[model samples]
Target: MSLIRSLRLDPLPVVTTARVELRPPIASDYEQWATLRGESRDFLTPWEPTWPGDDLTRNAFRHRLRRYAREAREDIGYTLFLFGRADGALLGGVTLSGVRRGVTQSCALGYWMGQRHAGRGLMTEAVRGIAVHVFETMRLHRMEAACLPSNEASKAVLRKAGFSEEGLARQYLRINGQWRDHLLFAMLASDPRPRA
Candidate 1:
């Protein structure tokens, strides 16, 4: 993409809440992102996609930027970095992916928080911001989140963000070392919105 095109396609602007900021990851984030993953390898390995040995390389971050920019231009996946507004520290990220419009305007939600950031209700608040953007701003009718049946933390975030447990999906996705079943949760436009 040309510089002008890239500028025009700048990932969606920052989304902020009283305690958090959802922004796109920049090149400068490489170091901290690398360090975070390095230290949290054990903490995140079970739930995350398989990470290759080279995933932390600088070039990997470059590829991620390109993917984020492309996804933004296509309105497919707007991945945002989560931050603690009080100190502007990187908390983790939230994403609205698989966006589908027309007769059914809907998408899926996925997120992760740094180890230290878990259980703090930060991801819950961030999910609320994401819900508002996808449902109200983008006019999407439904937003879905499914997590491994064992992920109580994620289930709590989904429920706290106003999604109701829909059911279980077998082999919903592959994570870490194998295919995993997920518990489906969804928040339709008709569902009560979480207080932001």
Candidate 2:
């Protein structure tokens, strides 16, 4: 595969809520993305994978964009950045990944909010909007999410967005440099949207 590939669809669909907009990040967004992630570093580190030495660099961001585009084109995943509708500030990101098709049409949800935007209800709104896209627009059967057992806020957000706790996964993922247990949550296409 080449570093650059053309996407069949021109201009990715933009998801909007009352307070925010979700869209794929483009090249020009590098600076704002870097700044937002930098400011929220300490607040976000615990729930995320360990940052690389050059995690904040432009080159790394370029690599991320390429991967996001490639996966989206291959119909396996989607990643969107959340921006404040009022001021266009970079707020955070939401992704539906690990997609499986055929017999099981499903994907996993992962999201994060900037420290300043925490507890504002924006992330919840984004999740609901994206869930609609996943089930209705993308026609996937189910969406799943996993979070650290200690993450009460995340657990609540998932519930508010219509995901029911499924079970626990022991040492599910490596987070902040350690393997951690995570509680699983899922929503199916037949599940009614909580905010609908």
Per-model TM-score, in order, reads 0.92, 0.94
- Per-residue alpha-carbon lDDT of model 2 for 32-123, expressed as tens digits? 89998999999999999999999999999999999998788877778999999999999999988898989999999999998999998899
C-alpha lDDT of residue 119 in model 2? 96
lDDT: worst 10-residue window of model 1: 2-11
Q: What Cα-based lDDT does every candidate model obtain?
A: 0.86, 0.90
lDDT of 2 at 27: 92
TM-score of 1: 0.92
lDDT by residue (1-196, candidate 1, tens digit) is 4555556633385888889999889999888888877887888898888998899999988999999988878777888889899997888888888989789799999998889778889999999887877777788899988899888898888888899999999988989979899999999988887685
Which 10 consecutive residues of model 2 have the lowest summed lDDT? 1-10
Error of 2 at 28 (Å): 1.1
Candidate 1 stretches with Cα past 4 Å from truth are 1-11
